[model samples]
Target chain A: MIESVHEVLTRSALVSVAATLVAAVIGIGLGTALALARIPGKQLMTAVVNTGMAVPTVVIGLAVALLLWRSGPLGHLDLMYTVHGMVLAQVLIATPLITGITLAAMRLLPSALPDQLRALGANRAQLVLRMWIEARIPLLAAAMAGFGKAISEVGAVTIVGGNIHGHTQVMTTAIVERVGRGDFNSALLYGAVLLALAFAVNGLLASVRHRGASWERN
Target chain B: MGAELSLRQVRQVRAGREVLRIDALDIGPGEHMSVLGPNGAGKTTLLRLLVGVDRPTSGTVTLDGVSTARRGVEVRRRVAYATQQPGLLSTSVRRNVELPLRWRKVPRRERARLVAEALDRLRVAHLADRPAQTLSGGEQQRVNLARALAIDPEVLLLDEPAAGLDAQTRSAFFADLEQALADRATTVVQVSHRAEEALRFADRVVVLVEGSVHQVGAPEALHHRPADASVAALVGYDNLVSATVRTDGEVLVGGAPTGLLHRGPAGAATVAVFAGGVLLADAHGPGLPVRVARVIPGPGHHVLALEGAVSLLAHLPMRVQAPLTGDVVRVVFDPVLSVVLPDSPADPTPGVLDGVELAYPSRVPS
Candidate 1:
């Protein structure tokens, strides 16, 4: 029992950590691009991103499953019912949340920054890098929000991972399985561990974001 | 070295409206030029075009006679534009000043030297290690100016660089800024709606109204011989009264002849007078009848409003006991100082008074 629970905890951490890393990278990049690019259909893209933020995670899971199912266009990859499939589904569920927060943070910046940087002779790459640096603290906050969504998400991961014992079982799926049987205590332990992990990650992020960010210390 | 900047028949259109139309404008090599105008008068737009950030809707803008249309981003390297808001990074002041140097990929040693010089020049060297976000608005603006100068730009455009500073701070900043650029061979194009700053700092001034150049000349010419009511108000004319030019070429106020003479064809003309041009006249003497309605005190002067056919605001040199309120006194303008221009047709759009009220009060803290 202890060994299985340990596997569940490790698998859950792996899935959330991998998904958060991938989503954060893509989301921050895409969000910054959206904020800075003045191309056509920018408003339309922003509207679509906002709508994507409201998409249900289960719907994402179903969509991904369909795409990766046998005879589906992406079926050649055979990501279904595998850990890779869970990561893919989790990424889809978390990217929008991460992206929405990052976009909002970048948008809140004073509009003159990009222009001023250009005046100072910054090339395109320099402008983007400077903007990212100025938005560092808030982007970290975006990461925290993304992690929260990725770790707590159940619908997408369960639908894709299949909750198979000793294989795809993560903490949340194990807890669900335990509840379906007569193992409430085990279910409670998994719940407690998930909560603790979330607190740990968020606390670390908060310290970096807010501590000594006062005027004097920058 | 210094670059000559000019606009040849340039026009800017926005939302299908021609917002700026300039036939010809020249900023001589190493000259300081200021453009004064009301809000939404396209002052910022003109600067943007000069810096080559935006192409003109028509015609050409040139730097040193080379057209800016095809200069590309490379043109931006030779010029620096700073807006009213001192947009500084959230990093150290030294870093903010080091930005231009960094973008040019200057060697680390040279970058440090240039950054230090810029900081010292702007008089913000003491705050070099402090976070730029922590500095006061004036300090941040100084750093912004320092960053602009770090590139040794040939043409510099500043939009209200000294804006939001107190009188003392503004003067001090300008003194430092001018000294910094005095030997740099840089041609500066600045936009300042403040009459005194433009008059004091710029060798040439352009007054813009409704996206068209109203008048361009020495600051004194714009101040003393404004082209019309709009230009008059922009040049700090406290009183603009429309009057008829009599057959004898004498302008009349309140249907009676005043001593002010005009050289234009006899018809309608608008009289423009500054506060210092108003002189106290004998009640029964050659001036018009007026009652002092209020006296507002300034640092070295007093503003007195007179009620006549139209209310007039005038600046009087500081006196121990100027005329009191409710005193009916005859006041006459210094004919040599006043201006008479052909009365322009009443504008279909909003008047310049509304523009003045809209621009100043919101910016200046009462």
Candidate 2:
């Protein structure tokens, strides 16, 4: 039972971390572009992103499930009921949240900072990079938020990964499966492990944020 | 080498309202030009265009004949701008000063030298290790200027660098700033609304009003011979009173001779009177009779607010007896301290005062 719990915890950590990393890359990039560029339909895009942030995990799971089903358009990839499919579903659920936070973080910086950076001879890339570093605390919070949403969500992984033991089951799906089988003790153990895993990851990230914040002050 | 900046037919429109329009302006290499204007006069808009942070709605702002809007980072690398706000990054003052050098790809050793030199020049070297965000406004501004100067930019643009500081701090900031740039031949352009700030340390001053360049000349030229009544008010001619210039060239205020003359075909004119030139005497002389309304003490003088057919202000030396409020006195305008500008119908008489009752008898000078 402990071995099974370890396997499920490891899978959960791997899949969630993978999804968070992918979501962060896409979210930060998109958010920065939206924040700085003078593109049209920006208001509409922001509205869509805001709606996506508040949309339910179950709704996103349903969408990903429909797209990756055997008869669906992406069926040729054969990702349905796989760990990759689970990661994809979690990414969908977390990307919008990370993106929204990032957009707000970038906007909170001094409006003239980008121009000041340009005036200081920073090229386009340097401007964005420096601004990100300036707002790194909020950005790190965005990443943590994304990871929290990714690892803790149960509906998306349940629907898309299908909880196949020794194959696609994560801690969330494992707890759900144990409870279904009336194995109350095993369910409580998986739940305890999930809570510990979240606390450990967030604690590590918070320390890194603290160091980044105090790097120059000291 | 310093870069020559020019604006040709430049116009800036924001929210469909024209904010700045300049037909032609040129700052020569190594020249220290100051753009002087009142608040909302688009001085900052002009600086933003020159710094390439903003593009003009029409025409061009060019550095060495290269349009700033189209110029690449190579061109931008030669210019630096110190904004009105001390926009410091959340870092050490040393890093804030060093980042520009880093951006310009200065060698590590050279970057260190420039950073230290700039910090020392701005008198902020002692604050190097301090977090920039924790400094006071004046110190942060010094750091901001230090960062801009660290790159040894050929063209430095300062937008009211000492704007919000107190009088003493502003004076010290400018003194340090002047000492810092005394040896460098950078083409610098500073913008400020205060007359003293615009005139100080500037080889040439541009008088901007309502998005238009009213006058551009040497600081002394703008101070002594402002082109219009509005320009006069901007350049520290505190009292703008309605006057008439006779065909014989004698200037008259309130149907009385003012002992000043102008070489213009003038029927009506506005007399720009310096506050120090409005001499006061007991109401027995051949001058305009006025009632003292307020006698405000100053550092070494007394400012008397006087009411007559027109409101006027007179600066008297502290040794002289200043009249109390409601004391009638005769005020005379010294010709050397006054200029007769052609009638600017749009400007109200006495540019700085309001609410004082002015009831002149219908007495026309013959």
Candidate 3:
């Protein structure tokens, strides 16, 4: 039991780390694009992003698993039941969270910033970059929250990656597996680690928000 | 770095509603022009169109003989427009000032020197390193001005730059602006609601009403000889009376001849009497009888509200004695002081005036 617990801990840590990096890259990129796009159906796109934020992890896992299955159209890449598959599922769930939160943050910036930039002769690209940098801290907090959410989710990884030993197992899945196998101590240890990670992410976000508010007052 | 600006019949329509309609305007190089108007008179919109921040629905805004609509970027580089509310990037003041130079691809050494000079000119050098979000309103406005000046554009467009500033700060800002203009061949087109500021600094004043230019002339002409009733009201003519042309061509006020008459043909018109133009004297003086209603002290004069069948106000100097309420008095005004406007058919209310037409051209013949 002790050996199995150690193996699961190591595998879960690796999967969490890999999934977090992938999710951050895709989520933050798409999130920013969605925030700045001036498409005709922008409000509808925003609504879809907001709805994605509330979707259960199991739903994302099932949808992504079905799409990557051997009989599915995208099965040519053969990503099912692997670490890449799990990362894909996590990014799918996390991207909307990042995009929605980023949109909200950009909305909070003063309305005059864009006009002012244009009046200063800033090209469209410069305006976008400057506005993004101005909104960086809040966007970072949002991306971090998405990272934590993806790292802590169990159902998505369990279904899409099959929670394979030494391959796709992640923190939440590993904790559930440990509990099922009567290794209560291992489950408790993993739970404690997850709680600590969540606390750290939330603490960082709180500090950023407080700092931003102070900057506004001055 | 002065550029000539000419707007020929520029009209801007948004969502089927006309936002700005300027028939014609010509601002020469090194000229300082002020636009005075009430709220929603399209002052900001006109400024935006002139700077290429907005495109007109029809007509043209040309800078130095180049059409801004066709040459957007080139025109923008030549004009610096500052909005009424200061807009700053969510970055350091230095970075905000460095933006225009960065856009022009200016070298780092030159950019730094220009930014420093602009900040120093606006007296906000101490705030160069601080984030713009940390600055006060006045400081932010100064920083905005610094950023606009950093590029040293030929034309400067200011929209209500001194609206929220204190009197002392406003005066200082105007003085700094004057010095800056003197140092460079910069042409300025500013929009302001403050009459005193416009009178003090503007070489010419243009009055806009309801999205159209009502009058344009030298500052003193607009102040003393407003083109119409709207211009008169905007220039601080607070005492307006609706009078009928009696048979003898004299204007009768409350059933008595006041010796004020229109220079044009006799007809219904609204006569505008500036508060300063109405003189108050003791009851024995040779003028129309009036009853003193109230005396209100102003910045440099005492405003006396006189009552009869019609109430009038006289703004006398501070040394003038205040008359008690209900005390009989006499009021007189120079016949030239009153501006009579032809009555409009839309407004038939006996004592309420709508539009007033001018009899003489207000501009001095060149």
Candidate 4:
């Protein structure tokens, strides 16, 4: 039983990590772009992002399930019931969270900063670079939230990945499976392992953020 | 290498209202010109136009005959603006000053050299290694100015850099600023409502009123001969009274001959007597009769608010025996020092004040 728990735990950890890693890259980039663009309907876009942040994991799961269901539009990719399908769902769920937080943080910056930069001969690209450096701490928080959201979410991954044992099951889905099988002991063990994994990732992020280091300062 | 900045027929309309209108104004190469005005006078708007950070609603802001709009990138490289608030990054002062040079893509060797020179010129070299966020208001402003100078800009635009500093710090800061500016042939255009500092620093001054030029002259000339009563009050003329011009070129205040002369046509005019322009004398002959309403002591002079048919403010040198409040004495007006500003028929007299019951409310004390 303990050996089976170990295999399940490892499998779950791999899925969660894969989902989080892909989500971070896409979310941060899309979020930063959304915050910087000055197009019309910005308020409407912001409202949509806010609503997306509140979207249920189950809704995302069902949507991805339909899209990759062999008869669906993206069925040719054969990603349904696969770890990649689970990652795509997680990315969708986390991108708006990042965009909303990043937009708020960027707006909090002093209004005089951009004007002063232009007067000093900085162009658009340079202004964006400077803004990133200046708002790095908040941007890091956005990344942290995205990772947390992707890892802790269950319904979406469970639906898209089908919770197949030793194949596509992540930590969240594994715990749900253990409980379903009436295996109380295994469920508790999986839950503990999930907590430790989350702690490690966030701890690493916190250390980097607080240290800020000479490189970021420069 | 200084740039000649000019504004021609510049009219700025904000929110469907004309906020600024300049027919023609020019700043010579390497000249220090200060735009002096009260609040809402569009002084900042003018500075922003010169730096190419903002475009005028209509008309051209040109540098060396090239319109700022046509050569924005090139013009921005030549001008550096130091705003009122110090927009410093939370980094070392050295890094803060180096950012502009970096933005301009100056070579690493030259960047370091220029940054160090600017920091030293602003007298902030000792704080170079310190984080810019930890500096005081004055120190931060110094660093802010150093960043502007790092590019070796030909034109420097300052928006009240010394505004938040204490008197001693402000004077000291400008002394350092002057010394630093003397090092380079930079044309400085500063916007200041503080007359004393503007007078001390600028070679030429443009007095703006409600987004229009009221007067443009040297500090001394503007102080001595304001364009009108409004301009006179701005330059610190404490006692403004209504007077009429005489055919003999004399001014009459309350039907009393002032012995002052103006080339104005014989009609109604406004008289501006600065507190320092009038005095109380113990001469053998009688002067104007006045009762002292208040006497405020100063470092070298005592400012007396005298009460008569009309209230007069006089600043006289400290006497061995100073006159007490409510004491009646004779006051003398220095015709050479006072100014006679012609009043248009449409403009109301600033002299006809309301409710000046501070001296004599209803009846004079016997």
Candidate 5:
């Protein structure tokens, strides 16, 4: 039971790390673009992103599964039930969360930053980069919260990732499978590990928030 | 090199309201021009238009004959604008000062030197490593000024740079600014509510009233001969009285007549006299009957409120022995220093003290 728990925990951690890295890259890029773009229908776009944040992981998983199945348009790529499919599902869920939070954070930034940058002769690209830097810590906090939410989610990946041994099985799905099979010991161990990961992410967030708050107070 | 800035009939309409309207304004090379106006007088809007941050609805703003709209990017590189509230990054003061140079892609060595020089000039070198948010209001303002000066732009637009500064700090800041402008041939255009500062620092002063250029001239001229009552109020004329223009060319204030020359209308007029222009007398002098109302002490002078048939204020040297409040006294006016306005026909009996006009013309050399 102990060895099985260790194996499941290891695989879940690996998948979680991969998903978070992919999500961060895609989420931050798209989030920044959405936040800064001054296009028509921007409010609608923001509404869509906000709606995406409230979507259940299970719904996203089912939607992705339908799109990647043999009968679907992109079935030719044969990505169904693969680890990459699960990664895509997690990225989809995390992207909007990061984007929404980032947009909100940018909005909260003092209105003076952009004007000051422009007055200093900074072009659009330079202004965007400077504003991002000015808003870095908050952005990081938003991204991390999205990463935490993505890693801890189970319903979406379990349905689409098809928990295969030594392949698609991740910690959350494996723990559920273990519990269903009456392997209480292994399930308990996996649960503990998952809890630890969540704790660490939260701890990091708190520390960052404390530093940012003090910086603001000063 | 210094560049001349000119605005030709610039007008801005935002949200269906005219935010700024300026006729022809010509700022010479290396000249320091001060913009004086009350809040909401479109001073900031005008500055933004000049710096190309906001496009004018009509007309044009040019730097050295180059149209601002046609060369906004190039023009921005030559103009630096500092807002009233200095906008600093969430980073250290050093980083804030280094931003403009970094945007221009200055070499690391040059950027470092420039940042150091700017910090030193603002007397905030010790705060280089501290986060900008840690500074006091005055410190933050100086940092903002330093950041704007980092690029050494040819034209600097400052919006109330000394608003939150102490007297000593403000003097020091202005002294450093003067030195920097003299050395670099930079043209400064500052917006200020402090009339005295405007008069002392600016070669040319422009007054704005309700989105229009009310007056423009040398600081002294604006002070002495305000274009209207509004201009007189702006330049700190404290004695504004509602008087009737009598037929004999003298103005009657509260039934007592003073030898103030008037023409045109006999209905009503506004008599504006600078506090410095009113002279205090023990008894009835050549002016009019007055009673001492209040004696308020000020920085360099004492403000005496004399209650005659018309109330007036006299600003005299602080060392002079002055009558206390309620003391009977008389006052005299210098006709050369007084401005008489014909009553607006629309409101013939304009209430004695309803609206005070504080917008005035700029002071110009006589």
Candidate 6:
């Protein structure tokens, strides 16, 4: 029982971290582009991103499962009921949330900041990089928000990963399996572990935020 | 090491409306020039053009004969702009002053030296390690100026550096600013709405009105010999009484002799009277009679608002007994404190008793 709990916790951590990293890379880049570039259809694209953030995790899971099911469009890859499919589903769920937060963060900066940077001899690339550095506190918060959302979700991982013992079980699906077998003690144990995992991640993120904010001290 | 900035036929149009139009203007190397204008006169737009942040709608703002808009980063590296707002980064004062030097790829050792020198110049060196966002308003402004001066650019653009400070702080801010630029051979252009602030240390002053250059001359020229009635009001002249120039060069106000003479064309003209020049006279004296409406006391003088043939304001010395409200007294104009200018079509002398148009050109062709 102890070994099974440890395996589930490690797999959950790996899947969520991998998904968050991929989503953050795509989302932060796209969000910054949307915020600064003068492109057509910007309003429409922002609306689509905002709507994506509100989508249900179960709905994304169903879509990903369908894409990976036998004889489906992407069936040949045979990724159904696997860790890869679970990570893909979580990525879809977290990307929009990160993107929306990043876009809002960039817009909240002082409007004259870009011009001030340019006048100080910063070129295009330097301007964006400096703006990102200036807004690090909020951008760090966006990443944390994305990671939290990706880890706590269960309905999508269950539908896609199948909770197969020893292979594709994460903490969320393991808690469901333990409860179904009338194993209340094991279910409660998994629940406590999941809560500790969230607290640990949040603690780490808070430390990073505090370090970034230290420069603001009087 | 300073760069000469010249604007020839520069016109900036925003939202399909012309905001700034300068036919031709030049600032010599190492010279300090001030652009004085009221709000919405496009002073900021002109500054942005000169800084190469935004290209003018037409014509060119050239630095040392090179187009600011067309030339790329190399040209911009030689110029620095300090905006009205502090706009400090959320970092230490030392970093805020050091980043520009770093962007210019200055060596780390040299960057530290320049940053220290700039902070010392603005007298904010003690706040170097403090977070820039935590400083007081005055401190923030000093840091902003220090950041701009740290780059050691050839041309510096200051857009109302002391804009939102109180009277005392504004004075002190300008003093520090002047000290910072004292020995640097950098061409500087500052814009402001206050006459005292704008003319304090400028080698030449540009009076911009309604997006046009009304006059560009020495600070004394703007004070004593304004181009027109509007320019007079901008430069601290409080009374713009309409008058006429006789064929013999005598001045008449309200169809009575003013005992002042002007060499302008003998027709409609305005007597731009500095309040210091409006003197009190006896009821039987040779001047226009007016009833004192109000008297406001100041440190060393009293300001009297008088009503009669023309609404007028006068600043009288404290030694002279001030006229009480409702007292009807005659007033005379001191020729040394007033001058006759070509009547302004834009701000027509409101109560002019005469109207015969004459073509009298201004000192600076408008």
Best by lDDT: 2
Roughly what TM-score does model 2 have, to 2 decimal places? 0.95
Candidate 1 Cα errors over 4 Å, as ranges: A1-3, A210-218, B65-72, B295-302, B316-321, B344-366
- The order of the candidates by DockQ, greatest first, is 2, 6, 4, 5, 3, 1
Task: Specify the poorest-scoring 10-residue window by lDDT in model 2 chain B.
Answer: B354-363
The better candidate by lDDT, 2 or 3, is: 2
Query: Which CAPRI category fits model 6?
Result: medium
Q: What value does the lDDT take at residue B134 in candidate 3? A: 79
Candidate 4, superposed: residue stretches over 4 Å from native: A1-37, A69-73, A213-218, B254-259, B281-290, B308-312, B330-332, B345-366
Across residues B240-345, which tens digit of lDDT does each residue of candidate 4 receive?
A: 8887877776666777554456566678888888786555544333345678999899888887888875789887766435589988876545654577777763
- In the order shown, the chain A TM-scores of the predictions are 0.94, 0.98, 0.83, 0.89, 0.87, 0.94
Question: Please, what are the lDDT tens digits per residue for candidate 6 over residues B12-122?
Answer: 998989999999999999999999999988888888989898999899899999998988577788998999998999889999999889889999999999999999999
lDDT of each: 0.80, 0.87, 0.77, 0.80, 0.78, 0.86
Q: Is candidate 2 or candidate 5 better by DockQ?
A: 2
- All candidates: DockQ: 0.42, 0.78, 0.43, 0.58, 0.53, 0.70
Residue B155, candidate 3: alpha-carbon lDDT:
94
**Candidate 1 lDDT, tens digit per residue, A46-134?**
88878877899889989988998888889999888888899998888778877888898888899877877776677789888888877
- Considering only chain B, report the TM-score of model 2: 0.91
Off by over 4 Å in 6: A66-78, B246-249, B344-366
Q: Is candidate 4 or candidate 5 better by TM-score?
A: 4
- Worst ten-residue run, lDDT, model 3 chain B? B352-361
**TM-score (0 to 1) of chain B for each candidate:** 0.89, 0.91, 0.87, 0.89, 0.86, 0.92
**Which 10-residue span in candidate 6 chain B carries the lowest summed lDDT?**
B357-366
Kept native contacts, as fractions per model, are: 0.55, 0.82, 0.37, 0.65, 0.59, 0.78
lDDT of 3 by residue, B54-129 (tens): 7899999999999877777767877898888887876689988998889879899999999999999999999988
User: Which candidate tops TM-score?
Assistant: 2
Full-model lDDT, candidate 2: 0.87
State which candidate, 1 or 6, has the greater lDDT.
6
What value of lDDT does candidate 3 attain over all alpha carbons? 0.77
Cα RMSD of all models vs. native, in order, equals 6.6, 4.8, 5.5, 5.6, 5.6, 5.1
Angstrom error of the Cα, residue B146, model 1: value is 1.4
Model 1: what TM-score?
0.90
**Considering lDDT, which of the candidate structures 3 and 5 is the better prediction for this target?**
5
